[model samples]
Target chain A: MKYTGAQLVVRLLEQQGITTVAGIPGGAALPLYDALAERGSIRHVLARHEQGAGFIAQGMARASGKAAVCIASSGPGATNLVTAIADAKLDSIPLVCITGQVPLSMIGTDAFQEVDTYGISIPVTKHNYLVRNVADLLQVIPEAFRLAESGRPGPVWIDIPKDVQMASIEIDALPEPGRPDTAPCVDMDELRRAAELINAAKTPVLYLGGGIVTAGASAQAVMLAEQAGLPTTMTLMALGTMQSDHPLSLGMLGMHGARFTNYILEESDLLIVLGARFDDRAIGKAEQFCPKAAIVHVDIDAAELGKIKRPHVGIHGDVSQVLDRLLPLIQVQLRKQWLSRVSDLRSRHPLLMPGLENPRSHYGLIDAVASALDPLQADDAIITTDVGQHQMWVAQAYPFSRPRQWLTSGGLGTMGFGMPAALGAAIAEPDRTVICFSGDGSFMMNIQELATMADENANVKIILMNNQSLGMVHQQQDMFYKRRLFAVDYQRRSDFVKIAQGFGIEACDLDTAENPRAMLADALNRRGPCLIHCSIDIEAKVLPIVPPGASNTEMIGG
Target chain B: MNMRDSNINRKLNPEQSGKAVLELTVRNHPGVMSHVCGLFARRAFNVEGILCMPVGDGAQSRIWLLVREDERLPQMMSQAGKLEDVLSVARHGADHRVFEKLEEFFG
Candidate 1:
């Protein structure tokens, strides 16, 4: 078969089962766009910005659990897409970034619109290739896609020079590259030692992380926890690994985690950590963290076993598979005394706010909004949150009982992540309703994404917790900087309702906490991408705070 | 809170001892460092000092960790060697015989 480099890309993409592509047309990438125009089978959306294009592809990939593709031109266009590529890499979202490079001859001569995109994205991508010959284009394109979707799942870059786009390629069939096997044999001796340690410990706790969901090990992690009768504390990314409402589940741990979860981690005799590496945001102090516990670290990536703190026993294997092996060896029983102590802490420090009792606090509004979405439980409603006070509040208040139900920016506290990430989540699973919870500050960063949500007719419910200020930063400044409120507070608020209307979506205002129940009910009932502007207290802050560099004992309550 | 009581408590609890420094180089990719550090955290290894710097080229980066653990130093090196992105692992401390021999010859 004979084809141009552009046609070869489209054909290779089709072979990968990619039905949708997101990008914008520009000088360098024009030929490829022209090539895509000839193909009627594939769907392409011209996003407003190169960054948006990358994010849209990310959204599609994240939602569908498939490899999503995004294309960009050379120079500034490729640079703009770098953020989303970095985001995909950080979140382990499978994405293929195809960018048009300057023509081969003009590559290093500093041409009008030239950029070394492949070099720029090396540290951020799993693998990247700059195709020099047209013959290699067909092979490289599919190879990049395969490398991106396989293994731990991350973005890959394929940089095609402009000349390569116009060059002809002769190919009978696109040969598939051999993939190195990621599934290594588990060390059974280590697994046996892990189980023996858990069985002998009077009180053992299961610390789960994002790996649980990424590797589809939630069931196994839960089984091991249950078999050992251990209480489970999840990292933010690991929400829904175990039911939040389960008696043995302690919800999130570390900074802004539930008091009971932190208490259990600090006091447990043995901690069986699965697929979770100790992140500072998750484990505040290395020296003081799990002070009394001997740790059993089990992870597919063996490097994570003792790189943070040394584990008593390190088992290298797939989290789910290892848990399955370890379950049979654990003595089936709960440590009654340990359970009682943890239960006491759970009740005493239950996730709630006294101010919420008045039904006027920001806490009350969040609770009401969460309650309204409860009916969608049967339909599998998903929530994605941006960072700041609201994100922490939602983590504490929202009850997520299913795995992969809560998608938020846990590793990187990128504010604008909520909307695009939610849009991606919704696109991945169309049957599920994706709710984006953003602070006033976070919403403004990626407000343009509302149009993408509208264009796609996604059933995404956007909850804007409008506080008229950067609540988190403002609180820190106010408390720590002697009430010196600088530019943190936004004097004027944009009418989000009008903004949603401009995007051709329905919008409503739940001005006060008292009226959240009614507004949420209405939004939940009729929704094809609707925004709920819930007014909240500007002074609200995530409390029971552990001041920076301070011990947990130095926590201050709200 | 006085110094006298803290010293007395230290005397009563002497098990908290031993420190070693280990250096690791991993591919400069997203979450490679996070995955490595997360392992350290899970093991409850006390990190005395840690420093990370990118190599001039983007291919790899270096991480230095000062750990306070007696029996777990070998385990940490073995784990570091297992990471997918890790290029090389080396331990440098008075405790490790390899480093001690090199030091003895050089000195």
Candidate 2:
């Protein structure tokens, strides 16, 4: 059978079970888009911007735990994808990004709409391929998918020339997709040794991270924590690994993490780290983080084991597999003294819940939103957020019950990630409700995506925490920079509700309503896509911030 | 190879700067190097030299990474060996002479 390279691209995506692709078209990508139009198997989402397309793909991948595809034209279009690709890499999201290039004949003649897509994307992607020949598409396309979703999943790039996309190729049969390499087998001896350490330690803590979600080891993680009777503290990325309200859960630990959580870690004799790289944000000071703990690091990526905190026992395998073997070997013990000590610490430095009962305070907006969306909790509800003080507030206020439900740009901390990612999540799970919690500054960064949301009729409820400034930076400047604010505050407040209305989305100003909770509920309930603009005090801060380079034990505020 | 063999290999040469060679046995697959390198890059850990080639039955490859000897090296060694494709990691002194040979060849 003879097929054009463009058609083959669509066919390959279909074979990989890809039903939707988010992208925009350009001169170089016209052939591919034309082919896609001819074949109706894969639905294409037309994003307002190339970055939105890239993030939409990230959202879908993050939501579904599958390799999602994004496309772009050459030059500026491809460069626009660089941020999202980098975001995916940092978060370990599996995405395959395809970009169209100029025809082979134009090669290095500085062709119009042509950029070295491979060169630009190299640092950002897990792997990249520049398909010089049409025939190589058969191998490259499948390999791109395999590499993207395989071990330590990340974005992969494929730059296909326009001529290659237009050229027809005859193939007897497509090559079989390659099997992903299996993780290195877990050593039973190491597992037993880890178990021995856990069994012996009077104070043990389970340090969980995003790897638990990536490995689908949340169940195993919960089981290991319960069986070992260990106190658990998760990084921001591992929020929903253990239910927020779980007794063992110490909430998030690090920079903005609860003071008690860090205290427990500091006091622990053993830290059973699963699938979490000891990131700088999570570990206030490398030498001081869990200083008393003998680390037993279990991760799929071997390189993470000794990268920051050297483990006494390094178990390199799938988190689930390692946990499965290690769980039975652990002898459950009642550390009444340790438990009481942790409880005492928790009571001493409890996570400040500002608006749990009353939602009218300056910091009560996050709590109000959480309360308003409680009904959606029983359904498939997802919360995506951009970076700022609001992001931390949502992380603190929301009780995330399961993995993949709380999607935020944790590692990369990209400012404009929420709106497009929420759109992507809504696109991936149409039946679910996606609430994007964005600060005024963050919302403005990718505000163009409001049009895309309206166009798709996405079921997204955006809760805009409008503080009228870059909240986190403003707070930092206030606390450390002697209150000298520069470029952090907006001189005039933009009417977010008016902007939402202009984008064809239902908009409401919660500050104007007599009953803010009722207003929030109304917006959340009656939404194909709606934005609730909640006014917040600029002085409101995400409390209990561990000052940079300070130990987690040393926090400035609550 | 075992620790003794690696130690003997290190002992053969006397050029011992404050560098260590981490020999990794990894599955021969695309992106394995990226995974290994990315880990270092993320932590801002600098790798001085790297050498990789496929070994036995073409199913696996051996990678030699030369990095400065620091407190983090022990942890880095464990981390590199924890990669999905990595089968084993053996550390040698900077005197391993693998990069020296490559430098000689290129020079």
Candidate 3:
């Protein structure tokens, strides 16, 4: 059979089971786009910006645990996807980003819309390819998908020249993409040694990270924790690995983590780390963190095992496999005294939130919204958040029940992530309600996505926590910089409701409503996209903050 | 050398700043190096030296990373071995001459 490279690209996408591709087409990509139009099986989403396209793919990938595709023309279009690519790299999202390049004849001639797509994407992508030959498209596309979704998944790029897309090639059969190489077998001896350490320990804390969710080992992690009666604390990326209300769940532990969680970590004798790299944000002053504990680290990524804190027993395997092997080798014992002491500490220093009964207060408003959403009770609703105070507030107040249910930009802390990610999540799971929690500062970064939401008729309920300032930075300045507020305030407040309405989405102001809860409920009940602009005090802070370079135990303002 | 003897050798070395060689057998793939390097880069761990070459009909590659000896080396060895394409990782003493040979050639 004879097929053009463009046709083969579409065929390969179909072969990979890609249903939708988010992108913007240009001259360099016209052949590919034209081929896509002719094929018409894959739905093409026209994003307002390439970055939004990239993030939309990320949201889909994160939600579905599958490789998601995004496309863009070369140069600025490709450049716009850089941040999202980097975000996927930091957070390990599987994305296949295809960019159309200038014709091969104009190579390095500074041709129109030509940039080194391969060069720019190398640092941020797991692997990248420049398909100069039409026949290579067959191999490259499949390889891109394989690399994107394989072990420790991240973004992969394939840059196709316009000429190649128009070039015809004859093929009888497409080669099968190579399967991901299997992980090394777990050493039973190491598992036994780890079991011995766990059996001998009096106080053991299971510290979880994003790897558990990535590897689909959440069930195994939970089983290990419950079977051993170990209290657990998770990093930001690992939230919802254990239900928030689980008795042994200590919630997020790190910079803004609960004081009691930090105290418990400080007191534990054995630290069983799962799929988590002890990031600086999670482990403050590494030398001082879990000072008394002998660590046992298990992770799929070999690099994460001893990158920060050295573990006594470091087993390199999938979290699920390692736990499955270790679970039966160890004798389970109850740690009543340790659990009681942890409970006492938690009671003494519970996560303090401003009363939700007082809806006028900023924290109160957050509490009210979270409660109205039934965040604690329902695991179906997905919440995506932007960075800053609102992010921490959501982390502290929202009751998350499962992994991937609570989506936020934890590693990159990228602003403008909420709305687009919500769009992606909504697209991934149409039956589920998707909520976007954004502060005023973060919202404006990618506010153009409102048009995308309206265009897609995406069912995303956005809660804009409007403080008219960069609340997180402002709080830090107040505490550390002697109140020299520089570049932190948004002096003029934009009417977000009007802005949202302008984009053809229903919008409301929560601050002005006499019955705020009823108004919010009414907006949420709408079948289409909507936004609730919440005016909050700029002075309100995310409490229990550990100042930069401070030990976790030295947190203040809870 | 057997895995048990190697474990004993690692335990005998206590100098945290001494140099160590990690030799990895990995499937030959474009992204394999990126995955290996990205892991170290994410943790801000530096690789003092690197040597990679394909082995046995280009199906697999052997990568030798020279790094400072720290308590984390054992764990890092375990981690490198867990990468999808990685078949095994063997640690060597600083006296291993791979990097030295490369230095001599470069010099």
Candidate of highest DockQ:
2
Q: What is the interface RMSD of each candidate, in Å?
A: 11.0, 8.8, 8.8
Give the lDDT of residue A145 in candidate 3. Answer: 83
* DockQ of predicted model 2: 0.17
Q: Candidate 2's chain A scores what TM-score?
A: 0.98
- DockQ (model 3, Cα): 0.15
Better of 1 and 2 by DockQ: 2
Better of 1 and 3 by TM-score: 3
TM-scores for chain B, listed for all candidates: 0.67, 0.79, 0.81
lDDT of 2 by residue, A1-558 (tens): 899999989888888889999999999999999999999888899998899999999999998988989999999999999999999989999999999999989968899987877667767887787788889899888888887877788898999899999999999987776445677788998988998899998999999999999999999899888888888988888989999889889999899888888888899898899989888889888877877788889988766766666688988889988887887897876678988998999999898866556555445776676677756463368889999998898887787889999899988899899999999999999888899988899888889989999999999998888889998999999998999998899999799999999999999887888988898877787759999888888888788898888888898778
TM-score of each: 0.83, 0.89, 0.89
Local error of candidate 1 at residue B87 (angstroms): 8.0
**Which DockQ values do the candidates obtain, in the order shown?**
0.08, 0.17, 0.15
Per-residue C-alpha lDDT of model 1 across residues A261-350, encoded as one tens digit per residue: 777778888888887878877887666787788888877666566667778898777776777677778888867888998899888877
* Poorest lDDT segment (10 consecutive residues) of candidate 3 chain A: A369-378
Q: Write the per-residue lDDT of candidate 3 for residues B1-107, one digit (tens) a residue.
A: 12233446667875545888989998886667877886677656789898899998999999999998765566667656655567888989999999988887777
